[model samples]
Structures are given as structure tokens and as C-alpha cells.
Target: MGLGRLSALDPKEPVRRYQRERPGELLHLDIKRLARFEGVGHRITGNRRGASQGLGYDFLHVAIDDATRLVRPQDRRSHAMAGLVQPAPAAC
Candidate 1:
């Protein structure tokens, strides 16, 4: 049988989907830190003797969209959570 027109259905009605969408619509974020290791029989120290000894960690933040495949980078040292607040959609 052929499918009938959707005009009979309410315009505001919601539809369910079996498949998932990708890019643009959704965004993912990730964070990473830099580490320093000492040689054998040696231990790492927190004291900074010089610029080389001032080893520190660097945080990496990333964002990926599910609909557009777009990636955006944020700050570091912390996890940034999206979807906490809803924003207006951008122009396509």
C-alpha cells in the first residue's frame, strides 16, 4: 500500500525516530592534562627550580556537533558540560 499525505495529522504533533542524527546539532567536549615523569630511582617534585622544572598539567577541551560535524575548543583544567542551558538555534 502507498503512504497517505500527513496533512491529516496535527502540525504540532511529535514524531519518533529509529535512527540517530550526526554533527552540528550535538556537541561533545573532552579535557586532557600534561604529566611529567622522572627517571629511574628518581621521584617527581612539586618545587619549581627553573622553567624546565616547572612542569605542569595542561587541560584540553573540545566540542563536537552531531549534525554538522563541527568542532569547537574551549578552555582547560576543568570539564565543560553542554546542554546545561538551551540557546537559540543558529541560521543554517
Candidate 2:
């Protein structure tokens, strides 16, 4: 890439650096919605008219420490569902 092409970008300043102190200093919670699959879908099973049914999604909660990049698997803090709160397995 040449400098002429790079000059077109807005705010051409360099990106800032970030650093954390300790392992448990900063943490971030993430909720990922995953679809519950019971059996083969219509596409896979070659049944075009077959309804997939009411296969709701499962919310996976994950807590990660930004500093050490260590995953702290815990529950009860982040529950995406409104009525019931459940903890997903740590396999994900």
C-alpha cells in the first residue's frame, strides 16, 4: 500500500494502547444465544415442509478477565432469559 491510498482514511492517527493491572482487575460478561438442536433440521434431513418446531435458544454466559485472558466460568450474575435463570455448561 502506498501513502497516497492511506491518506484517504479519516483521522489517520495511530491507535492507542491499553493495559490492565492484574488478572481479576477487569472482567467482561458475555451472553451468547445458541439455538437448541434436538435432531436433524429440515435442510439436512431433506424434509422441506417439515417444521423445525419451537426450538428455542439457550443463553451461554461467559466471564473473561481482560488482563490475563483467563476465563472465569461462573453463573448467577448474567442471565439473559427473563423468567428463569440457568447456568450453561463450560464446554463452550
Give a tens-digit lDDT track for model 2, residues 1-92.
Answer: 35586657666689997757765556566777777767777768788675767888866667666676666453334533431212222222
Deviating ranges (above 4 Å) for candidate 1: 1-25, 35-51, 77-92
lDDT of 2 at 11: 62
Each candidate: what lDDT? Answer: 0.48, 0.57
TM-score of 1: 0.38
- Point to the candidate with the largest lDDT: 2
Question: 1-92 in candidate 1: lDDT tens per residue?
Answer: 33376665546568874332733455455665656544432234455554345566666666555555555555553434453212212411
Cα displacement (Å) at residue 75, model 1: 2.1
